[model samples]
Target: MVLVTGGTGFLGSTLIKILVDQGTAVRAIKREHAVIPDALVSSSLVQWVDADITDYFALSAIFTDVTQVYHCAAKISYQPADHAAMLHVNIEGTKHMVNLCLEHAARLVHVSSIASLGVSKNGELITEDSKWDDGADNSKYAVSKYESEMEVWRAIMEGLDAVIVNPSVIMGVGSGSKGSGVIFNMVQKGLQIYPPGTVGIVDVEDVAQLMVMLMNKPEISGERYILNSENMSNKELLDRISKLLGKPSPTIEAKPFMLGIAWRAAKLVSLIKRERPSLTREAALAAASKLAYSNKKIVDATGYLFKPVDRTLEETSRLF
Candidate 1:
């Protein structure tokens, strides 16, 4: 039997499908208030339970008969006004997963983020040994993820078996309208401009597969693996999307000062709009910051291959 948290999410649902294809009994945890995906509901091979992991008793009940665990649930938003809630989900929730895994003797596969390791100190493809000291500069999303990784290290000290996969910005088919909205909004709105910058890339399917491999590889415990396929400039990404959508691409690059003013103004509108601000100062910094990482370690360690960037873009574009 296998346990998958966030199984209806982009990566987790794909992982659940993979496990079901392999004839493994899969159980997943989700909120009772949330809508369950039809595929998971239709599959007789999967047991979808509505429960929150932060609740110890709920998690204890779901972990039963679970030989291996995939802890993929997470909460990353544009600007998390509720910092305490985000911490509970990302930090303390991880602590619960570690404890529950140990109690069930289940092999744990934790889904971490590249932000946890902070910026690449040398402006190069960051490897596992790269340090994260800019926890203060990054957003609450980044801080929460960084602290979550620390939780794993603490678990290792307590003799827990686990492996971590750090993925760059994920792009692919997603569940409902969540998780990938920033990218979706840009594509949906038909952007005529984008800020000048570069960012990392990874397909959702690739990340899902890597998690299964890490779960099966005993030697992967206590290691962090990066899963990035390319380092692409903002212009390049917009151009690709433009060409696919047959629309004019954003050519004029906005100056950093101009972007800052626009972002602040947009944030003010956000306060009145009653939803997340489109142009947050935090989002702008993450956008402007160079986001690239090394995936050679993941390739060499797990024998995983990535889909070509053009193909990944094409498939995901079909969604929009």
Candidate 2:
């Protein structure tokens, strides 16, 4: 059986469904009463367990009959309490998973973020080799993911058969969460105008298929793959979404001065509310950075090509 941590989560749910449809025995970890994604309803034999990732002892019992594991759970949002919680789940919790995998001798596919991949200089394109290692760098979310990946790499070095997959803002085929959720809210409010920046996009369906393909391949045992479809500017992304939703695209461009005001106002409101601000300075900078990556390695290794960004974004917009 395959054990999926955070299986009820955005990407995890879609992935689990694909596995079940293929007649694979699947087990999932569900945390809350949030509506389960449409993907999970297909397989009646699939098991759903209530467990937090940080509990290693409980996980040890759970992993007894599991042969492969998909570690998709993570604490990624920018909240005040996220920092401490992230360290336990994303870092220490992953270390625990690594130990469990080693003990059980199971194949582990770890899900990470593009945030863990270090930024490029002068708007250059990045490859899988460009990973973030040092501390005192990137956002809290980035640090947590980086540390977790470090644990996986460490396990690999210590004779664990683990493969890593880092995704750039996963879109498409998910039920209003992760990057899809953020974009959903933005488009619903007629957020057509965008900041001056670019990002790599990936449809979650394509990514989930790639993960399954990777599982059957033994050559990429210790490799890390970056899953991205196409590099798109903010304007391109907004334009496509607008077209998909039949909304009026923004005519008033977002000037730097206007963004500065909005970010500052959001920061002030967050401080008074005593919470981690949504539109923080770092997040805005991350969004506005010209971050694009090459997926040639992933594509070549798995022989799975991703669909175009426009099609993926349009499909995602049509859902919610």
Q: For every model shown, what is its TM-score relative to the native structure?
A: 0.94, 0.93
Q: After superposition, how far is residue 122 of candidate 2 from its true place, in Å?
A: 3.0
Please state every model's RMSD to the true fold in angstroms.
1.8, 2.1
Query: Model 2, range 1-320, lDDT digits (tens) per residue?
Result: 89998887778888888898788988888775645666566568578887777888878888978889999988876654567887787998799889999999999999988888988866678888885656434778888888899999999999999899999988886656455667766766888578887888888888788888888777779988999999888787777777777777766666667777777888899889987676866666666677889899987776786988777776777677
Candidate 2 global TM-score: 0.93
Global CA lDDT computed for model 2: 0.81
The per-residue C-alpha lDDT of model 2 at residue 282 equals: 61
| Residue 248 of model 2, lDDT score | 72
Please provide, for model 1 over 98-215, each residue's C-alpha lDDT reduced to its tens digit, 9 standing for 90 to 100: 8888888888899999988887765786778888886347788888899998988888888889988888888876633565535645766777677777888888889888888888
Error of 2 at 182 (Å): 2.6
Error of 2 at 152 (Å): 0.4
Worst 10 residues of 1 by lDDT: 175-184
